[model samples]
Target: MANYVFGVDIGGTTVKIGLFTTQGEMVEKWEITTRTDEGGKYILSDIAASVEDKLAEKRIEKSDVAGVGMGVPGPVKADGTVIKCVNLGWGIFNVEEELSKLLALPVKAGNDANMAALGEMWQGGGKGHKDIVMVTLGTGVGGGIILDGKMLAGTNGAGGEIGHICVNDDETEVCGCGNKGCLEQYTSATGIVRMAKIILNTTDKPSKLRQIQYISAKEIFDAAKEGDELAATLVENHGKVLGKALAQIACVVDPEIFVIGGGVSRAGDILIDTTAKYFAQYAFHACRQTKFALATLGNDAGMYGGACSILNQ
Candidate 1:
């Protein structure tokens, strides 16, 4: 009678939890504050307590639960060892084993980005595709690669750290990852704003972007939609770097589709269309036809993906 499963997506601010049937339907979902106090010592215990309370409220016995699958904002090895999670104040440890012991159920864990990709593949934008790559463009860039229905977690669980891929060796500034000219430096929300500032500083062209003291990626895209030449140029520049990076990834993983998510993806077709153009321009001829779409699940992707992981197991 193990008909239900639990999915947990842990973030710096909150932990999203979902109850799902074995058939992949999310029955209920809730969130809890991610208390990072005392080196995050209480996080696991809090989650266990929440699960117990939820089960009791639903009048569902533990024997009716399948398992728990979790997504953490860090690299996770196949054996469920978390390399580290600075935001959670966690060091290298076996997250799956520890949580499993607390909840007294089987547990599976993966990088949050990878879990999002799996979620998209299961029921979101990447549905019906076994090979897909998901790119999330928020404050920073993160990616997940799913090939033939399997997450390619590299030896160090950094297989899909596509943001850190060196895109410009000639650049002098350092990225957040301490790498020079990483893709995230050129494609993320902050990156686009940085590019807009560079364009404003280097060019004499009249632009609406010049009027705004604080620019955002959305503002730039909005200006582009309004036919602002400078904003369009910035978008094109972002497209070039993003497309180039994705093309490189395609040559290796050759995913059937690319699903773009995160806050910046709110630009919708403008972002997808521009990036797809660049991807086609730089892509190997064999990959020129690769599909691209926007992620539909938004924040819930991680929750759905966590449940999918347990169901698949």
Candidate 2:
């Protein structure tokens, strides 16, 4: 086996890279700005140059490296073909081949969310479990499903696109994905604020939320924890939608546990308890025993997961 591995998580604004031992111990991590100009033609080359520089600075030989693993912010086929990553201005192309040729080493790639799930399963919240679902509740809801320690990439590389699942048919507003009433519409960080605004406008609940010029998910959760009835109710409603959706997902994947991550998940016990309570109510009886935990890897999860991908292969 090779001595070290590199993990790369490609984002719209930056690319996070981590150097790790083959045994999964992260040695160092860093980031570089994402140059998305010219249809992202320079992104991969830039990453390759960065990795090369790191190798030289560390005095690590290319032969001693196992391979590089990458997480891209879009659907990626098992063969490393990125369907499209609009965030990076990338079109359909085989990413692994390009990067591998650039570095003259083996490489692997997967969806960013899926990589996060792998990272959790490897050393974070989903540790010791082979079946797991990771939910990231940020500006948008993102998810990744892993079963028996394998990612379900699906035929179109959209297997774990849980956020796009239609949850409400009556929604009149469109989501970023051009869908209405998606699970993301009610469960993401933005979704929390959006719902709070609706409640404050439609009803005179006299919420602390009304005082903030710019309400955020953090403030809402803080108010709920501090005994604000309106905030608590909003949190309950948000949890209800999220729990119900997770229950439906459980019926399909039957994962061992759900790992919650992202900015909104910082609400901690309030988020987990409320969601778990409703999950038990809606989950299939056999699946009600599934567990929920917060992701421990945080922003570094994608990096760990990217490395884990190559190591696993």
Candidate 3:
């Protein structure tokens, strides 16, 4: 086995790569635009070349490398074919076979959120806990589940898609998946911003938020920190929706802990404090034992997750 493993997170906008020691320390990391519009052929070629260049720079031979793992933004078949990638403009990609041929190393591929969960399980907030759930609050929400010390990817590989779980029957805004009332409609970063806009437009109340043309969820979070009642209420609204959805999920899975991660999670206690309160109100009494915490691995969790996926094999 090689002395180091390589991890790659294939996000919608960028590809993050990291070289990691067996002990899970990241030695070096970098990123490149995904540019998936160029076709899967060029994408794989570029990845292969980049790996080759990195190996040469470090004077590491292929024989000294342990393995490679990749986290892609879509479902992957057990045999490594991508079922489809909505963001990458590709379908049925033979990721493992093609990349292994070019790089002369074993490659493991999995759903990006699942890999992130694995990373948290191995090194972040979920460390030392076998059964865990990771919720990433990004442009959208992504969830991953680990049960009985194993990552659960249901048949057809679409499990843990918690964002689409319907929470508000009265909500009308359709999700990208063509569904209305999904949890993301109220819980995602974009959803929070939409709520902020509604508050600004509907109320005559004076507020600092009106000065900005396009407000982001982060701005709302910042405003809440400064004791803005409207911003605080917006966050509370988001928490209630997310909590209702998570309560439903918790009833079924019963994970030991829930780790919240991603950029929006940086809202810290403002988000967590509200979420914990709402989650308790919404969840069944039996599920009250499940602890909630922020993810410790931060942005590198995706790359670490990719590496952990390889370790699993």
Candidate 4:
């Protein structure tokens, strides 16, 4: 009988693999280096070998496994085709079919961000809520939307590209997506540092942030926590933009909760508190009271989400 499932989260540097019961309890997890060489020719074969070794080590029969669910770092078609993943040196291809053929098992795939949100909804911050939007703030911002317990992987797989939402039409600098004034340009970790530099250069504000040679989003939050005036301003500005964008998202999805994750979310309550404050200020009346929470699963979220996908399927 099919009693187990495998969850794989593919990243630029590593691939995180997890073994789980059909009930969603993780049994074991491990990682392998991602070989991006030769246009990622070895990635699928490597994963197949690793999965075989793991099943053998666990004495689990191939027939006893339900399937493998993978999370890729790029847009994925509904049929599990990856359009492209520059970081992984990949081009358009059917990841599901290739990996399935290699392993001789069923496979399912989705965008990593969407998988993270699914994980959160299944077992993390958004567990109790069926409708939620997850925003991941790292070097850049990533997002995913879940409605009525299903992921909305829209046409072209760009449903939850919230980071690219144009927030500042006046911005002179273009975003990584080649857009000017994207939400990521102001709310990401790098965006915070960029804003801090502009604040330091444009204004002679007597603040502790001016002392740091290399400023990071964490540093800014730390200084803000200590009551640094300029740092507080920067944090507030970050909150304003982020909260406003979230409010806009709420207008569309009307999710019950907003789960915040990624590296920048390390600021904890301060980030949520400030963003909530601004969200209330700008949100539509009916959605103004929407809840916000921090993602508790961290990096393992993708693994859990991958497993959830197969179980749900």
Candidate 5:
């Protein structure tokens, strides 16, 4: 039986790869620049070459390795068909079949967000949980849903796109997804900054943020942590918007926990506590007891999740 597994997380800038024991322990992790030129034609071949190099360096034989699992930054069907990945300059194609052919081994592929969720469920903050919702609050919000330890990648692979959930029908501004009032517009890093501008413009309240020409989620959260009243209000609104959205999600998935991650999540306990407080207020009584946590695996989560996915196959 194969005793090793490989996890690959392909992103716009880099491809993170991991060699792991079948049991999920990371043997080593590394990354390679993503050559997205020419429709990303060289991406797969590049990954295959890197993997081969790693195997040779470690003196590991192909027979000792299990199939490879990968995470893509686009919607992917259960059959491994990538609908599209504009970042990678890729279009619809059977990613698994192509990659598998290159390595002469089986391969599995999934949405990058879902892969992070699986990694959390496998060994991160959601380690002990069976059902989980992971939200990544970066420049934009990304979401992943895991049920009974399996990824809930919907038919079109658009599942767990919590950021796009329409939370504010009144929003006149269009979201990056070409929609209005998406949850991401209020809960993501850019969303927070957007709200800050709106709030500052309408209110005469004094805020340190008003003095800073360029404000980021970090500055806002830091000010809130220092007891800045206006910043606090921003956080409160963020919590309310995110919490209410997650409550709606619970009515559908009833996940046991919500794991928060991404750059904005570096705000740590303040972010979790506030979001949880609001979650309890809006969540149904049955799901009000759902737990909350911060994802501990960080960027390595996708690699770990990729390995977890290999086991499923």
Candidate 6:
């Protein structure tokens, strides 16, 4: 009989779980709606049930599994307690201790973005690299930093918050974290849409984008490809902001490579090209030599990271 490991990534709307062999091959995967509005305690019960169901389906005993790892969206204590989860509307809670007791197995926990970075390092784009930075551009910006081959979580495990880095000192749009002018204000999917709307309101340019009922970053990218000056310029502007932000981060971390992921990254080389141009301009000459690559792990990164959490410590 072969032993396996279980990894779970808990998110706002859903929870993804994966079973993997020691060699890193994912043998099974599944997801369940999080129903977070129902409260945090319900989530714990559901997770326990889900693990039991998976074990039964595979005809495996608890002893057959090596360990279980989890990724949470909020700040986690080094000891595995959740400090707070704004998205889930919960305050401080102990996830690791509770889960381990309920499941009768060792459980490791980490911030979701940090786990994603570990996933990339262990099996995805950063496989060969020891020092890496993983950034996710989505509804909001998310990140995880690895330095000198170690997953870096400062004293409270909130250290990898590259998204919260201030990009505009005087600008006012407040972030969910209550700070103003955060990097997410410019680079997230919502930020891109906000930038597009600003152009739409200020310019009288003839654009196919004006016809859309609702605009998204995808529509903006498509319109830019079709030669809409407003859309193209918006992308360029976003690229510049993203590049500048990255350059600043690179100067401090000096990681070997920076992997870009999340939904917005689907724009591919166009986004990469624009961001790279600005990154080159802002980065120190020596830092400009660092590599920027698209993330290869996709959504599965969370699960892989969970499966490999023991390696993180």
Q: Using lDDT, give the best candidate's number.
A: 2
For each of the candidates, give the backbone clash count. Answer: 0, 0, 2, 0, 0, 0
RMSD of 3: 2.0
Model 3 residue pairs with clashes? 2-64, 2-65
TM-score of candidate 2 versus the correct structure, residues matched by position: 0.99
- Give Cα distance to truth, residue 59, candidate 6, Å: 3.2
Candidate 1 runs further than 4 Å off: none
Model 6, range 87-132, lDDT digits (tens) per residue?
Answer: 7766787788888888887888889998898889889988889889
The global Cα lDDT (0 to 1) of model 4 is 0.93
lDDT of 4 at 94: 95
TM-score of each: 0.98, 0.99, 0.92, 0.98, 0.98, 0.92
Q: Point out where model 5 deviates above 4 Å.
A: none
Query: What TM-score quantifies how close candidate 1 is to the native fold?
Result: 0.98
- Candidate 5 vs 6: which has more lDDT: 5
How close to the true structure is residue 188 of candidate 1, measured as C-alpha lDDT?
95
Candidate 3 overall lDDT versus native = 0.84
Pitting candidate 1 against candidate 2, the one with the higher lDDT is: 2
For residues 160-247, write the lDDT of model 2, one tens digit per residue. Answer: 8999999999999999999899999999999989999999999988878899999999999999999999999999999999999999
TM-score of candidate 6 relative to the true fold: 0.92
Candidate 6: regions farther than 4 A off: 35-38
**lDDT, candidates in the order shown:** 0.93, 0.95, 0.84, 0.93, 0.94, 0.86
lDDT of 3 at 173: 76
